[model samples]
Target: MTRDGRRGEAADDPVDDATLALLLEVAGTPKPGNVDRRRDLDDLRFEAFLGGAVGARPGLERAARAADPGAPSVGDAFVRAVEGMAARAGTNTQFGCLLLLVPLVRAAADPDRELSPDALDAVCRATSVDDAVAFYRAFEAVDVAVDDPPPGADDLDVRRGSDAEPALRERRATLRDVLALSVDPTDPDRVADRNAAEWTEGFPRTFRAAEWILTDEGPLADRAARAFLGLLAAEPDTLVASTLGAEAAREASERAAALLGVDSEGPGGVGDVDAIPTDAVHGADLDTAESLAERFISEGINPGTTADLTCAALFVALRRGAEVAP
Candidate 1:
């Protein structure tokens, strides 16, 4: 997309816009755990992520254009985009982000590029069984790290990948059906995520984050970083719970809350004395944040769900005409 207030100029094509969002998510400072522009995991480098974002751009655009009226379903677009990303990055860099973006892109593909919670809901609610099948195929394409299915869904374990395709067909489950398993009321302990919540319900958090990004006074990167911290403080990241235990996730949330000087599960607390922007306060906050990031990174605790939510927020801001810097 063109810089904000330049609506008269032709916006970046859908591919370019999606690519920029991916880059911005990884490039955000103090976005602990996940690979950013300055941090790299042993197997995943920042350069590889940039390549994966570039590689997935065309597929994301094609998915957007294909679903303008309706052709490729979100599931099909998701599988294709992840495949392209994996081929370039040689690892799973953006599978979770792609899950959120395929639907967002479809909703934004209208003549006006208008995206609302209702529009996103309609797009997801319209998913077909074929979309479910394609989603399973996408899971097979990459070894995505996910929480295990509940006892009831043991047969439909994602680790089985295409092996579960036969059962998915036998059950005639739609993409919505598959996602419902994650957030099912029967299995209260199952880890529900913002992505699955978006797929099953409307994307409440994603839309709210976007609104915060729009209203917050700062450059896009600062807004994104603060939003990331805000969300992390407010919610226990499901990815952390999935990889570690619930207690670890809770601790992570508490740490994030302390960083921003807010009560866990409370508001952003931007004006709190603990959150003041004094040089000493800022330095101590970064020191604390860096310490937490170092501990998580060393322990392999990646709050990926938080990262994915940030990407969805970035996508919304860009689609709604936020100015991005080079």
Candidate 2:
């Protein structure tokens, strides 16, 4: 039970004290609920990307897929085909989300994305809320209600303007810019504008951050894997065996650390959130989208771990036209 006597299991995992500290840092933040202000763009990307097969697209679905290709590995061929469609579709969020899911679209991707121990942390960092949502729309199913409330209720507080419409109008604003790649990639001014757009409307910054984490010594996988494992609650041994190659004991220690707030080190905790440098963000972006997504997923994106709601939202927005994932 929470301090208020309500019940909450507080997300957990089995890892060393230090590792658990990092895991909790990513998972224990105060997330936006059904009626909250959070947004899980990372999880959204993963969900949308992994949700379905790209081949679901009728006529284009079976151009090269042989019903019985006696190849040693069909996964590569399938991924190549999906990646082709994604590139042709271009670098837009919708397309990017499709690209990340290329492996999944062809078949049941080894839920692990083939991450070796050397790349485990890198890939996890790679999968933060920001980048994950962009290319994983089909796999999206993270739950968050950023949708504007019914008109005239007049109770919302996020907006400070007299009229709620204008205060948070941009939240619901339609995706306006035409999808066009820049001709001058090296132009500083153009790059600034592009960067500016990405903070509020574009997802490049978030994706880049995720990409960095996935490739560097980041904590994306631990955050994602733990949340996924616990949410599924499918027996840690089985889950770890299938995914982490054997690390169930690590989850318990991590869970304890997350709840205790001992050495937490990410944006979800108040310390990490506050630790975010103002100059670093430069008045351009909002809070970390991945922080919100990871928190929400652990909290229960939809009372289940098999799917993610954020990914679903990305899919819905793309289908409706938002240029790409959240």
**Per-model TM-score versus the true fold:** 0.87, 0.23
Candidate 2, superposed: residue stretches over 4 Å from native = 1-173, 176-201, 217-268, 271-326
lDDT of 1: 0.73
Off by over 4 Å in 1: 1-6, 66-70, 185-190, 265-288
Q: Lowest summed-lDDT stretch of 10 residues in model 1?
A: 271-280
Residue-level lDDT tens digits of model 2 in 123-189: 2222222222221222222211221223442333212222333422443321121111111224321
Q: Tell me the tens digit of each residue's lDDT in model 1 across 24-103.
A: 88887667787776689888888887888977876697677843455667777888898899999888898888888888
Candidate 1 colliding pairs: none
Task: Please report, in order, the local distance difference test score of every candidate based on alpha carbons.
Answer: 0.73, 0.26
The local distance difference test score of model 2 is 0.26
- Maximum-lDDT candidate: 1
